[model samples]
Target: MNVGEWAAVIGAAGSLLGGGGFFVARATVKAARATAAAQQAAALATAAPAQQAANLAVLEATVRRVDEENGALRGEQARFRSLLRAFAWTVDRWAGQMHRAGIEPEPVHPLVEEYNRTGV
Candidate 1:
């Protein structure tokens, strides 16, 4: 072929190849970006349940602590009640002795009356 013809043919081929390569490079970039976005979404999805489980563990620990505090409060209340009852019994005995020695007895306690009647 003539020099001019050969040059024209080679130039046309290079232009076509360059244009096709540009399109291929753009498609490759888009695919890589899409893959990266999908990976990020999957990572977030996997972490969500773990976060919820961690929150549940914290809540359960709080509930357990509260339950322990409530049990301690109940035991303290029982001990205080027992001490009060012992004091009441001592007073009742003293009042009875005073009556036997010539003083009138005090009226019975309503709580004691109720307890005697109901067995509580």
Candidate 2:
């Protein structure tokens, strides 16, 4: 072949190689970006359910603790009420003894009558 024609053939081959390399590099970059995005999406999807379950567990624990506290408070209230009733009965008995001994009895309050009728 003539030198000019050989030079043209080599130049065309180099151009084709350069264009193919550029196309391959662009395809590789796009594929890598897509893979990274897909991985991020999968990780987020997996983490979301775990986070929700943890939140639910915490809420359940809080509810259980509140219920236990309420039960304890109720027990304390019952004990306090029993002590108050016992004191009221002792006061009434002492007053009765004082009346029998000829001392003037104190007037009964309405609240004391209600307390005598109901243990509360």
Candidate 3:
């Protein structure tokens, strides 16, 4: 072939090679990205159950702590109610003594009356 024709053939071959290399490189990069994404998804999938289990454990611990706190509060409430009842009894006994002595007793508190009525 003539030198000019040979040069033209070489130019065409170079252009095809360059374009094909670019396409191959682009395809390789795209495939690598997809593989990385799949790996990340698999890792997250494997970890999800462990994460959920940890969350459940934390929730159970919190519930147990709250229940214990509620139990302590109930004990305190019982003690307070007993003390209030004792106070009410003492007041009633004093009022009876005052009445027997011909002295007028103070009026009963509304709260004490409500507590007696509701047992709350």
Candidate 4:
């Protein structure tokens, strides 16, 4: 109705609008922060399985290397056994020859048999 009253009304309306705008801006900022956090979590979730697979691949390779080493050790064991058996056979043949010539080979018989007990 009066110019002074009208000015007062306009001033109150402007204050309300300015306060509401500030609140809205603050809410927008909070929502943006929450969205950014959610996106980061999703990125980590997506990469987790790929990281696990890479770790498993490394473990599998280590297992294969160990298996190969075990195979090499088995081959070495077989060679050692063959060498022991050959030595035992040579001792036995020497004993037989000595026996035919009327020489007693009893003293070395037990030493040669020591090689046979290792397989058990």
Name the top TM-score candidate: 3
Per-candidate TM-score against the hidden true structure: 0.53, 0.55, 0.74, 0.52
Candidate 2 C-alpha lDDT tens digits along 60-107: 999999999999999999999889988898998999999899997878
Question: Residue 110, candidate 1: how far off, in angstroms?
Answer: 2.0
- Collision count of model 1: 0
Please report, in order, the local distance difference test score of every candidate based on alpha carbons: 0.77, 0.80, 0.80, 0.76
**Lowest summed lDDT window (length 10), candidate 2:** 2-11
Instruction: Please estimate how well model 2 matches the true structure, expressed as its whole-model Cα lDDT.
Output: 0.80
Q: What is the lDDT of residue 44 in candidate 1?
A: 96
lDDT of 3 by residue, 6-119 (tens): 445655665688765555555556666777799999999999999999999999999999999999999999999899889888887888899999999777789877876886
Of candidates 2 and 1, the better by TM-score: 2
Give lDDT for model 1: 0.77
Clashes of each: 0, 0, 0, 0
Evaluation by TM-score, superior candidate among 2 and 4: 2
Clashing pairs in 3: none
